[model samples]
Target: MNILRDVSKLVCKTDRRALASLLKYAETGLKPQYVCKGHMSLASQTDQNEDLDKLYRMVEVEVRGNDPAVLKSYSWFTTTAAMELGITVGECWTPRKANHERLTLLKSVHIYKKHRVQYEIRTYFRFMQFLRLTGSTANTFLEYIQRNLPEGVAMKVTKVEITAIPSHIKTHSEPQQLELPATVEERNL
Candidate 1:
């Protein structure tokens, strides 16, 4: 008889606006241009727009097993794996403060056991990296997980699913401006 149950979903949500701002700042190297609105050539702008759109995308991974201990270990290992791959990972906290407080208290009071594990990859580059690393196949991803299972832990991964979620945030490219100092003193300043 099957005794293991799927765990509650663990999601990692990204702030699109913040990510856009950071990307903009990184490209322009000027704080003022971070939020400035502008545009570029159609072809180049389309590419930039695509990249920006990707920044807010997400990839959901689902894994199932029959042993809570093994599942838990696998979850922890995958979290570390994501970090090792230079991916950003974070828990999605509830919007309400009261809910946060209640969740914290409840979590502290009991140890929840889960069989199914799910998490999200919230960045475009990281998601691409994950696909590249895993050979862009469900079997490969499952094998990677199975191979990395905690030393002595053994569990059958009944299913592994990967889903790509597109970004809802609209993106536009901003114009880049550079100013040259005319004098040595101005350049130093």
Candidate 2:
């Protein structure tokens, strides 16, 4: 099993104590997270680098397919933008049933308005990125009907599925958020 899958499964097992163990295991460090969205959006890196210190990918991906190079490049750029914006784009590859079997990501990008810190808005998640290491990977992008896209921002989703299926494009806007109620986590069982 991939280290992240194992880690996520382990973290999901117990309650209060498990979270502490997960923190030690993940070592996301105690440094304060960069405040955005009226809350801590992302934390500064544990190890300092003179340049490009705040954001480093915690996952490594491997892809095999026949597609336009420009499209692939565009996807990468968008994903990076999403990361900067604090979108909870799962660092997962295709065959999604397995990736999201227990977890469903309700990810979005929210701008702090006055602040230019484009923040990723994860509606909810079970784990952060698995781990950055050696592995063969696929795409596990999701298609959503963007319920509430604020403005001046565009949502770019993965254009294809791992099984070579042509997934439809989806965009979220204000109207959709009106439908779904807020997350009720305590009663998940």
Candidate 3:
């Protein structure tokens, strides 16, 4: 099977608004100050629109509009969009003191799948570099974190499964294998 072709379908084209909002939520972790009017109208739908609403509230601090309903309908659109693109919502991603503040640090990625959907339950070591990742778990992200995490970094991980059902568990055909990077730098956290 052609792997690049399979993966490019998801990576090349993504909803810009949704991606932007998700990234912001991962960074700041705050609710929105903007008034998204669509939120109230679509409160019942458990889909992408809802995910956007929730993420906007946390990321978009500007006054989006005065409509209270719109503001509320802005819900968690992350899970749906990520699944369509074969991605998961990454957790526990943070910037740390690394490389004289030029890079970010993180731990190994822990991914979860359920009901043929994918949402990331892993950490991101947001650094600048080109890397390759191929597997169910986010081993690529971990590779970046490991490679660029300066001389020292600290991360903590607790092995507790989340209550929410994973999105891609049903589709996995067998046990997975991770093609990890050859060099991995360790940190204390």
TM-score leader: 1
- 1 or 3, greater by TM-score: 1
lDDT against true structure, model 2: 0.36
Which of 2 and 3 is ahead in TM-score?
Answer: 2
Prediction RMSDs, each to the true structure: 26.0, 27.4, 29.8
Kindly list the per-residue Cα lDDT of model 3 for residues 37-93, writing each as its tens digit: 333211232233543211110111111222323322321232233345554444312
lDDT of 1 by residue, 4-104 (tens): 11100111124455445544544665432222223222234224444321222233444443344454556677767767755555441112211111112
Which pairs of residues collide in candidate 1?
A: none
lDDT to native, each model: 0.40, 0.36, 0.32
Model 3 lowest lDDT segment of ten? 53-62
Instruction: Give the residue spans of candidate 3 off by over 4 A.
Output: 1-135, 158-189
Among the numbered candidates, top lDDT falls to 1
Model 2: per-residue lDDT, tens digit, 36-154? 23332224334354343122234333332223343245446545654654455656433322222233333435633444433333221111232221212212222211232222323
Where does model 1 exceed 4 Å of error?
1-56, 92-143, 146-189
